[model samples]
Target: MAGGAADNYGGVFDGSMGFGAKPALILIDFVEAYFDPSCALYAGVEEALKNALKLRDAAREAGLLIVYTNVSYTQSMIDGGRFAQKVPPLENFVAGHPMGAWPKGLEPADDELVITKHYPSAFFGTSLASTLTANGNDSLIITGLSTSGCVRASCVDCCSHGFIPIIAEDAVGDRHEAPHKANLFDMQAKYADVLPSAKIMEYLSELKL
Candidate 1:
């Protein structure tokens, strides 16, 4: 009999990069475009949003640095480059578009850092890595929309940038389940420590600031 998926890669890919001493919580692209049913990018990820909110509050209470990211592009999408060309739906993120606004309950606090990115990976073409390093953050608690796209990209880059990527599995979602689950499995095996939001919240609570 064949072993289960976990059994197949047990020793090779199952190693854990546990939480680091100084961690930051980053919410990626939890914008109105993903939550509004009328938007082309609507992902119906309300449950994920709820979980992210819980994690955000927990991280805030723990006094961890918090960062929120949103997609924004010039009207002509000059800075968007090939990404905007590949996905025309990105037009919704053009400056001043309603779809680019933050969803009500998920808005970043006044004091929280908000990074406006033009691409999928939050660290790509952005100062995220530098910001994290300067702030002495050794790890990131990552949560956001579209598990397979922005979330996965951010996780990989987080690892590449030498920051531990702790993905809040239930706090990230996609338009469909297949890619979401596949990406989470892949991330766990290669890039990040994929965990449930509740577990992440517990971890945050246990952190010493």
Candidate 2:
């Protein structure tokens, strides 16, 4: 399931589901641990990181509020509960772990926000919602790793909190291609506007605000 080929559906997603303007960028779990092949992460993560970097650059130029989410647990992992138990890889994602740190290439800017989350959804048990609200971000452009788990969780939670979730399809990946494809398809059908990264770039380019 890890190395299987995925059918890339370029330009196939519907974008009308998301907010028309005022978009922000949320990059989730793009950490060294996820990018290292030696760890329990995806294979083509290097390629995904390249796309995410491009997205981040464009968002920054467009004056979008950029937020990065990292999974950091306590030494005992007592705070995460059942979610962390089911996914034992999370236990290694402690605050000081090298794997918990953001990938060097996509490190946060001084003005950007870096959120430490114990759970999958960035909005859950974090100040992400309030931050977005304060910044007047009604729509979110999500780019990250492990699409099936954290990405999907954040998308639904963002929608529930009244923020339109727009997944940068080419900018998100998972430990396995199957879960990536399945979650993208599911998010497209139900929660978020699953658009390719290129299309989102076009929207940002045309923004007059």
Candidate 3:
């Protein structure tokens, strides 16, 4: 860890948040646009999607509280606010748009918690924080698409909200490898404990939830 350029920075961001029993798994922005090769937002994130589904299965078997997020805007796109303006392609997520739908295997079950937002950070204007707190989830395992955008934003917000964020590296992705890898490094350095999917599964094994 000391050999990297990031090592020059003070130890202010060093240290892990460790694991907790009541961990909730968050699968962020896995909409069809991210996976559909024909879509402009597609990133060929097949590997990340595979890893996420595996973790999703493991979480279900372990009976962990799972949360899913998707970007949904009104047909008028007025509800999208500033973020939607920043990324005009986000118009795909507007109501009636096919790209807003979650991919087949990753769709949330009827009982699973669903958080809809028009912003990057899930906690920005959503009830995710209160919901996780109410469910007694002191730790959050985040895995999803676009590491540099929503994933990074959600990781920082998750930490700020006082929940230990465990970012599953193998299960998160981006349109390109560079930003994906860069964000993961920065996140591990500043905001969260970045772990591979296998390691997260190990943490899940010991949980009674």
Candidate 4:
């Protein structure tokens, strides 16, 4: 760890953590396709979904912007690229499929933002950055499934876009625990602020969101 943020769990502070400002929330790939028991991301979907609900409530009460990233591909674009070849199973996630819909109880509110992405990184080839910038959001509280993939990619891109990426460790999930733990460690080491939800909530409460 280049900075002392890795010790932040015990009340250590780094000026870079971006706590006081109102943050936007980005929930990545929490749809039914990822939740299906047959999918590779299924194992921890239940836990992720529960945590996502918690994050949504907190963000809503804090008056922070809420954004949801749903991974969907049109049937015409099914054979897109290397990612599709690497995981042919994803072709089934075409738009309009029931499995591709946002999971029950997790739909975005009318005023919230919904970004449809064909790739893992939410900011890649999407309007996510512009949307956040337009709202004057400097910090993002991110949570969702498959922590090593979409979550990590989003965190890195969030930083690149000049926004602080705060990865809520407990609020994220993966197909297995090892990748989740490893990615969280790696993301905290260089790209983002990885912390538990309670501490983040405390920071947000004091911010005047």
Q: Which candidate is the best by lDDT?
A: 1
Where is model 3 more than 4 Å wrong at Cα?
1-4, 10-12
TM-score of decoy 4: 0.88
Candidate 3 per-residue lDDT, tens place, 63-172, comes to: 98899999988888898887888898998898768998988888788879999988999889999999999999898999997899999999999999999999999999
Assess every candidate by TM-score. 0.96, 0.89, 0.94, 0.88
The per-residue C-alpha lDDT of model 4 at residue 169 equals 91
Clashes of each: 0, 0, 0, 0
TM for candidate 3 is 0.94
Error of 1 at 193 (Å): 0.4
Task: List per-prediction Cα lDDT, in the order shown.
Answer: 0.92, 0.84, 0.89, 0.81
lDDT of 1 by residue, 10-49 (tens): 7899789999999999999999998889889999999999
What candidate 1 gets wrong by more than 4 Å, as runs, is: 1-8
Ranking by TM-score: 1, 3, 2, 4
User: Which of 1 and 3 is the better model by TM-score?
Assistant: 1
- Show model 2 residue runs off by greater than 4 Å: 1-15
User: Which 10-residue window of candidate 4 scores lowest in summed lDDT?
Assistant: 9-18
Q: Candidate 1 or 2, higher lDDT?
A: 1
Look at candidate 2 and give me any clashing residue pairs: none
Q: Put down candidate 2 lDDT per residue, 47-87, tens digits, no spaces.
A: 77888899998888888889999887889999888888898
Candidate 1, residue 20: Cα displacement in angstroms equals: 0.7
